[model samples]
Target: MRNIYFVRHSIQDLSVQDDASAPLTKAGNVLAKELTRLFINKSITAIYSSPYARAFQTVLPTAEKLDLIIDTHADLRERQAIWRLDWQEHLANLWQDFELKADGEESFADVERRIVPAFQQIYDDTEGDIIITGHGTALSVLFHHLTHGQFTFSDWQNMNMPDVYIGHFSDENVLVGLEKIAR
Candidate 1:
């Protein structure tokens, strides 16, 4: 079995305003330190993260602690929800019906297409445990795909910032077990 972990970025400093450049908050920095503790003896082979600063920062502690290089992937970014109204509701509907999309938003299907392969490629190309630092919605969609819909929208809603989801996969890429590593 192979293990892969997805670590959602810690709280962002909303004051920074830029989506891609916003760094984590001071408390989020503390969370990143705590994040490092999860990989203490896991022998993680590589660290991958969304290009966003907050997501990258969340996993930086662990990468530095393990002396591993952090790889960035554009597809791992937060779901583009630039639509003007009730974005959360729109997102929920989009998740429920993967094809729904606002004019400027990336639909769930679109995101699935982009991220799932990126995720699988990382898994297929790596050995040992792997850690991926990603955004909430994007991770949720990817998780849903990986677990074959065993996780739900409510699960997505309940996710905490800086959450960890560990997945065990078979050689054929079938998920055998999925566990949420408590923060």
Candidate 2:
């Protein structure tokens, strides 16, 4: 059995102008340390994160502790352009219709197209337990893809900042178990 851990980035400072540049908040920093503690004993073989600053910050403590370099993937970023002007409306629109995309924004299918392949590549290439720090929407899509759309928007809504999603995979690329842990 191989396990992949997907951790949503910790709380972020919402005051930043650029969402991609937003760093973790003080509480988020503390949570990062706690995240390190949670995984220190898990024998994580590799660590990966979104290119976003918040996600990178969330994984830093653990990566440092484990002496593993954190690899980044652009597709792991949150649903793009949702953080742009009238982002709340954009987010609502996204949930209402996964196909909706504003200029420069990504539809759910677009996100899935990029994210799922990266996730699959990681699953196929990696050995032993792995950790990937990502955003809410992208991670949700990945879970939905892995479970053949068994996961839903409600599951995405229920996800917490810094939540831990554990996926257990068989040798045949079948998902045996999917568990979510809130922190």
Clashes (backbone N, CA, C under 3 Å), per candidate, total 0, 0
Q: What's the residue-level lDDT of 56 in candidate 1?
A: 95
Please list the C-alpha lDDT of all candidates, in the order they appear: 0.90, 0.87
Please give the distance, in angstroms, between residue 126's alpha carbon in candidate 1 and its true position after superposition: 0.8
Question: Clashing residue pairs, candidate 1?
Answer: none
Q: What are the per-residue Cα lDDT tens digits for candidate 2 across 1-183?
A: 888899999999999979899999999999988988778889899998999999999999999999999999887888776346776566666766778897887898888899988888877778999999999988988888888878877888888888898999898888998999655
The Cα error of candidate 2 at residue 181, in Å, is: 2.0
**True-structure lDDT of candidate 2:** 0.87
Q: Candidate 1: lDDT of 116?
A: 95
lDDT of 2 at 103: 81
lDDT by residue (1-183, candidate 1, tens digit) is 889998999999999868999999999999999988889888899999999999999999999999999999898998887846776787678778998887877888999999999998888788888999999889989988877898889899989988999999888878999889888
Best by TM-score: 1
Worst 10 residues of 1 by lDDT: 83-92
> Whole-model lDDT for model 1 versus the true structure?
0.90
